[model samples]
Target: MEARLKKTECVKQAPLAQILPPVILGGAGFSYQVYPDPNISQVRQVLRQAFNLGLRAIDTSPYYEPSEELIGQAISEPDFANRYPRDQYIIMTKVGRLGADRFDYSPSWVRCSVNRSLERLHVDYLDVVFCHDIEYVTEEAALDAIGILLEFVREGKVRYIGASSYRIDLLLQLAQSVLDRYGRPLDVVQNWAQMTLQNNRLETDGLKNFRDLGISCVCNASPLTLGLLRSNGVPVGSLGDFHPAPAALRTAALRAADYVAEQGESLAALALRYAIWRARATSTSDFQVSTITGIGSTKELDENISAISQILLPTHGSPINSARVERDAPLWNKVQEILGSWLNFNFTSPEANWDVQQQKFVKLKL
Candidate 1:
């Protein structure tokens, strides 16, 4: 067993809202889906560098095969363990949706999953446990899973509980359901691909919904839309093969990427900047906002941090780079104009058809 470390003073005292940084290190890239045959030393270096740079919160899931285990191994290294105790950083993982067609949200599976995650992560307790892709399961099952997580909170196995989904409306509904059923609002809610340059639904449709529910922390993930907005195009292989974006959306993204390239800027960097700006600008006293981005290497980590610094910080004592902002403002508007009808357009998930069938069957039985 790994030796237990003392909880950091700040983590022990602060609430979840204060504990999470504005930029979180996403672990999806650690798996074979995004990166094949990831080196342990590289993972260690990336995690250590991310910690040193203050991107301490790590988000992963079991579905991202080997991600939890790789992270566990990386953080368990003697040098890493000594320099950064477990409490110094936060670990957030998910449960349910084991495979594309598989889901198990029963209380028994919830209990088993939490214990397995603890064992795989080599941690005494998880900082946050989300019901992964709650929209794929029935509402009752989602609620049952949340109740199980809340039990863990009371038992000291988890620090906070939330639900994640690509569907904004479903997330809002689940939050309200949890509140009405359990007498408490969800502590956190995460949605991906909705707060990007092509889509701002998370800002337009999600913020007020979460605020109304009194959620404490809201996270936006996949600022690059699963690599859809990149110059090369949407990724294709393990996870990328399942990207649900329609051809029209993909075409629009390519046009935007071409426009960005013409202006001598990479679409990925522009998207990251806009995502960070939106998260920071929309954050309010009602809830804190954070963005999660995948980092496969130290270089990517540095570039992401650079983007954050450019967007949120001022150089020396001067204000933000207004000149750069002015230059990018027109570029951003032009990209949106290029997107045109695809702006704020959200593509259906790969499982949308299956989910619709399941819902209809449920209604037929009722």
Candidate 2:
């Protein structure tokens, strides 16, 4: 009886979110480009594993090939549906990117895309809908898209509205402008590859902005930093041929990958833990985050879920600190420093070039 008491005390757990999972199950790994095409049954099994492990949200996009359809089938399957009703979980998908280098944020496209997403997810409504990658389109285009999506909200088709992108400045601008013009703030915003072990820009700047804009939450996606900070290294030609990363930066990432391999640690594990640990915190105690990461298979999902649970678990001497976030700051800094000149390699924003930036925020008459 005494041993049982001691064992029970050793467990660590955190409260779940009121409406969604704190950690979102991302669909990018299920995309054809990342993994071999997944069959419907495989997707069903993967979703089952994730749900059993306490993940209650799934983030996908129309651009991620057949990911939406596969997810739809898995969640709507007979056995799973009987056990978990449609209201038991949340689903988020995006629109605005049609093909490689093709973007259309027009009102017509936005409505059409949401309708298709509804069809693919096998749900009458979506919990959330992002404008996809706003950095690649104009502010007017995005605003126009938002107006159309809101129409669905009125019809009870969308629960929340938001945008997902990589550019902090553009996000800030869009949020402020929308608030100024519409009298209501964006429900949420998601940024990728910027809140990981190697990069800290999103935490340093984006979170503070989100708080002021009344954004409900800030989500971090792609904690692997687009595979650069991993041991296997990023594959070539995956992010399209334009590749904003410079040659020198790519070489530095490879060297850093090699350094990571020599440490006798799984770089993927360290990277995942680092991102997950910090993602569980905020600049002020008033904020919270929902991190989205892709899981290519059940193996990857198990590793990621275990990593997150380990980070959230209470320690021997101290409990998980809720007042102050960013648990492994010192260790992360050490790892970043040892990477030498490869540290903090990042993309230059499109706004840096006057002519190119003009195309991204052109004003259009509504």
Candidate 3:
């Protein structure tokens, strides 16, 4: 049996000074909820391959059941330790949101979650920790969670603090509120499915808002819109019927997928290429941008890396490939055309409403 490696010392850096790769490995795919019967060997292989390819940052959550544990187990292996040290990569996980309908942002839960994540990731300190799905919680609770995270920072349990949400309006409100209350901007903010080919609101509506508040890193997650943009359609089975996108958007996605297939290109790849290119094109020095993609297998990891390489060139002048841009333009335009009314549409998520005075999410009306 291989020996488990002891936790190595990590040199802490300022939150803003830490750099994330153009792509982060999203860990939701590692859970049984997302991928049935996840193989530990495969997970270990994917982690090593991703690190070797320069995609070292990982984003997971307790909400992702067993993901953090699996990742912790993988990295603890002696071979993994021999290849990659703790400080060489980044590990980002979330707290607050537990089950789909459950959330806890109280200070006690915040501290507990942080300590639990530290143990599960097998690290003495986390590079980044997000208050997962802040929009679902009340404004006051979210603020309290951030305060606790700030306390953790002082204690050396965490290096950076952030919040992840699907609602652009709510995210902006939270960032501004944090700045006003804490006198410091969130080190990072993450929004999923908003920066994909079908929706560009994170760029169109969010960039300036976040920049105004001095937020440093903006993560564009779920470039495939949580599997909706793929030819196979929205993910079913263990992921449950949890996709919040409406029927109209799903139908339009199907049409767009079919159109892209007819053109001998994958809608999923086109979407990823567009996302990677857009992130590079829109990123500024003050507000660095990156994308997070879930890789269930080494094959998916390779595909994501290929997409990143194809879009991000080696040239110093511009990271984007003008040739690839010109080639994909028509296909992208046609996909948008197919989307039509569904273009840039924002879907409603569960518990979308929040009552500021009550300090909790108001149950959605049927």
Candidate of highest TM-score: 3
Off by over 4 Å in 2: 1-18, 235-263, 283-286, 314-331, 349-366
Candidate 1 colliding pairs: none
Tens-place lDDT per residue, model 3, 193-230, is: 98988999999999888988888889999999988898
- State the RMSD for candidate 3: 3.9
Of the two candidates 1 and 3, the one with more favorable lDDT, higher being better, is: 3
Poorest 10 consecutive residues by lDDT, candidate 3? 1-10
User: For residues 1-366, could you state the per-residue lDDT of candidate 1 as single tens digits?
Assistant: 011224543234345676677778888878766775666777888988888776678899988777899899888878888987886778999988686677788899999999999998898889889999887778898999999998988777888899999999999999999999999889899999899888999999999879889788898999999878788877654554767788888898898999889888988888888887788777754467888998788988887788777776633333245555666788788888998998988776535345532532232232
| Candidate 3 CA-lDDT value | 0.83
Each model's total of backbone clashes: 0, 0, 0
Q: Which candidate has the highest lDDT of all?
A: 3
CA lDDT of each candidate?
0.81, 0.72, 0.83
Deviation of model 3 at 257, angstroms: 1.2
Among residues 3 or more apart in sequence or in different chains, the pairs in candidate 2 whose N, CA or C atoms overlap within 3 Å are none
Our model 2 lands, by Cα RMSD against the true structure, at: 7.7
Residue 130 local lDDT, model 1? 95
Q: How many times do residue backbones clash in model 2?
A: 0
